[model samples]
Target: MAERKHDRKFVRTFFTTPTAVEGEEDSAKMLRGAVGLRGMKAPDVWVPDNEDATAPSMRDEGAENIVEVVAENGADFPGEIHPRVVWHRDSPATRYQGFKHMLQISDPERGAIEHIDGFVIPEVGDIDDWKKADEFITIVENEHGLEEGSIAMSVIIESGQAELAMGQLREEMGKPTNNLERLFLLVDGEVDYTKDMRAITPTGALPPWPELRHNTSRGASAAGLIAVDGPYDDIRDVEGYHERMTDNQAKGMLGIWSLTPGQVVEANQSPLPPENGSWLLDVGGRKVELESEDGVEIYDGNRLSLEETGDGYVLRVGGDGRELDEDELREELLDMTEYVPSMDDIVDSMEEFEAAKEAGRGAIAITQSATLRIDGVEIDVNKDRMWDEATYQAAMTPITLFQDVYRNRPDQHEELAEMYSEDVVERAMDVGA
Candidate 1:
């Protein structure tokens, strides 16, 4: 993977606010409001959108709004600002228009270039098409006297050739010059991709293209860029949005596009680790949690069964049963239970392991115990999780995310303090320091 160029720690939410509203008397009212501190609360990357979100008639005014609003509030905004410029591989006219907008917004006189992180080019086609957009930005940088490769280029993967070019990104890293290293993110546009593929769906709706999301995640990882899922059009379906985020999180795509402020807050917090820890049982291929009655853990799931034999208790897993003594049964049951650590639990474990490593221990074992009752038979189950250097590094991911959020979104500090407490937040901020 190529090294990233910018200083953004992580991008959990990429939010795009429309630059102009058709009926609104002040066309740039939406853009002006979105650039304020309250409007830019949770998103790590905030975009003053000048593309599809705005109509063609208002785009010229929209560009001026981006420059004006960003100049006024960009200094106080916590997130990185990247305007979405209009571009199409098929039309040189549209591409030139986008280039002109980039020049207008990026001119040093505007005072918005310092706050702007990059530009998101949409409707990108093949590798050569991608290079043309990059070249335009290079010229804009030279024309504006900005440093070479200062303005990053992020492309949306909305076409088959663009998706295929992702695999070729590493090879084309520094062919002509190191400008490609200015690449920041690989965003997905599933609506256009679906249209491009001519896919027919039963409901006449956009298909949930899981393979496209997977490919985007893999491609971004291979090229050392952030992968962001496209926006969910149904803004009111909070539960559905969470489900999609959970699925995307499993694929290592932590970033998601947010169209509304409510969705921005949801997407920002969805990728972080759970606030509390819980235990889950792996039954066949599904994860089921044990039920608790009074003070005893009860296992009454259909996938698992317990039988009492004359010799001993027999544990049935799916369709297989094995006779085991009380101690063996407890061991078997504990092995089936997986402990998902909460953010606080992870911090505690990492701190303990860090101290151990400082004291010359190569590896350490931590014991976690739970009590459960099976068919009137009660047993104490204990399991040990071994932690090494690699385990500690892996455990730091959530902590690192917390630190990034706490640093970038001071507006969310009180919420973070309430969720994880001030002490844990302080420790998180000091983890890598």
Candidate 2:
């Protein structure tokens, strides 16, 4: 088989192509928009309509009925084309040949069709059902000569039963460790899951839905599956949309389903690391130097107040009733010092500045785990907090001193030989530190 990028760069932000196969023109128009969206890594070729639609009949429904609903709407199994085709070949409910032709005929002209990254199977209820779908994929490969194992395989953990049986289902599917390279867990089908659990909420809020979402993510992580969060129901609630996407990202979900182009940005976004900067902090009437991450905040409090002066705003220090003009604040003349970086000791500020450009901040990394007592709560702010609180200075100190002391003293070096005791120098010079 030809090398596929899926093993390296699998889908991140999934764009479910609009169910376009109901009509060729409709399908093309919708898919064009879906694929064209910015930040869209890939989209599933959708099989639409009865995608988990519970039958309205007052009788038991079977996989046979599902095959009919899928066949009625099955124009292309881009989502799981092969398994779907195999499932309905002898059922007589769908014109399976026409579906295959649609994929073959329509594929070449679809502008971004070549970017099809994977297949998705929705409404996966039981082990036998998944196995049949798996067989369909094999059949497609053997008969149609589609590239074997080219695209990743994914399933929506939508149905309640599916959520419970996910592990067993994967085991039965025989997704080997190698084949697991390109795998996915799309957390969706909350609506039907609510129905299955007989769960209800008059407020239409996800009362118990968060548990389902977490379970999907938890299961996916346990099984080493890439967890893509399902789509948000309402597109217009932009703030809520962002919050929901952020929530999923925090849960370690890889991506979220995008119904609109706008949601893509939020789904792909990572939270901005906390901004830290040097500032003059007055402690006990002395100039005490402090860094931003030391729980010292200059914003919001009795520290200072702003007032509108005729043309501009004036910052007045609170309680002391002193006011400073812009020029004085910018100058280092008065007890005010520029925010000196914690790394300023490693090299001259210029050298430290250049080192930042040379080494990516995430590189030259250290993993430190520590616990801090915050407001009576002992919080373990281990590596993650350190990662956030890290300033370029603290990270640069060890490198210059350790490499056989290869770093020549900067031209503007300060004579700080007296600052270190012999052991301190030894440790700093890799004797122990």
Candidate 3:
């Protein structure tokens, strides 16, 4: 069937970093470089299943920098999930941050994690997919020693089926428990999604994929779930990867997948829009310079102000006014300015994200549950959950089982707003608008 224009759009840019366990040398290099990321914050490492997950233990390097360790079941439980993961003899490593399996939310990993944070579910195309996920979760708790809603389950929106199923999916979001807390949207399952959209006419480079990406993001935003961007496989294409990530950032993706150590700096970077700058304007080809105090108005309308600091000249905007949302703006500014992190050290990229967060510029990532305003719209987001209202109501589940930080504390609002800002949030809200 043909698609419509009013599809849901992606809100936050999510970078689901994937590393191929093949070729020991390359994997090691990627891991080493990733660990050395400027801010010392490691990228969200995705160690897929059907690989050498047990041996070598990528756990050490991944210990600190890891955000969410997604054991993608797609590689093993391909096409569709059947009941639950067979849970081979192996599969350990519990001490990572936000550790969970990425099986289809429709089915449980059974004994995958008797006590763990979360799991993954692929190709969540519609309400039925979630309904099936709900059923599967029930089976796990009743028969497999799986505590109801004890583990957080996430969803991946790949393929045309999930796109078509968006409307219905929204209606059935929380499920029988209303305890369903968070939904993790996999970055790019469209590699498989395009295959599913076979019936639709090929719409050139940006087919159902981009639209599908936009829709999933919007759905997640509306539902207050986390939407991650798909991985960029072509590793060596450094500049190309940055450009693609820039595109995703434009779409307001939370974080982009980091394939190699080199890409980490780029992924950690927030969009550099020149809302206020003579330097940025010049970099953007506007060639504007401040001659006198009267020239300050050159950046009028923009909430930016030019100042100096230990790190060369700094452009600080009063509110969140934006200038250039393109690489030329940042590149030109970086080239024109004497910002630190020198030529030999890419520390600028590493420290830039953290620095931005500290300056109240934007969020490093959506590390917790908070309300995000994308384009003046408020989105209530939570990163954890229980199984369902039915399960909770039946006393089969514990309401306070998951670690959600704070549940509606008035004081935390300001802190959360600073963590996940509107710049990143606004990216997706403006989709199609």
Report every candidate's CA lDDT. 0.85, 0.42, 0.38
Task: Please provide TM-scores, in order, for all candidate models, with all chains considered together.
Answer: 0.88, 0.50, 0.44
What RMSD, rounded to one decimal, does every model reach?
3.1, 15.7, 17.6
Q: How far off is model 2, as Cα RMSD?
A: 15.7
Cand. 2 TM to true fold: 0.50
Give the per-residue lDDT digits (tens) of candidate 3, residues 110-129. Answer: 33232223445554545555
Q: For residues 277-392, what per-residue lDDT tens digits would candidate 1 score against the true structure?
A: 66777778787767767766777767778887787798887799889987788778877788777777887888888889889998999887777776676778877899998988
In TM-score terms, candidate 1 sits at 0.88
| Candidate with best TM-score | 1
- Supply candidate 3's per-residue lDDT for 430: 27
Error of 3 at 433 (Å): 30
Which of 2 and 3 is the better model by TM-score? 2
Q: State candidate 3's TM-score.
A: 0.44
* Predicted structure 1: lDDT: 0.85
After superposition, the stretches of candidate 3 with alpha carbons farther than 4 Å from their true spots are 1-41, 45-47, 50-116, 141-147, 177-182, 199-208, 271-278, 281-433
lDDT of 3: 0.38
Report the error of model 2 at residue 30, Å: 2.0
Best model number under lDDT: 1
Candidate 1 local lDDT, residue 25 = 91
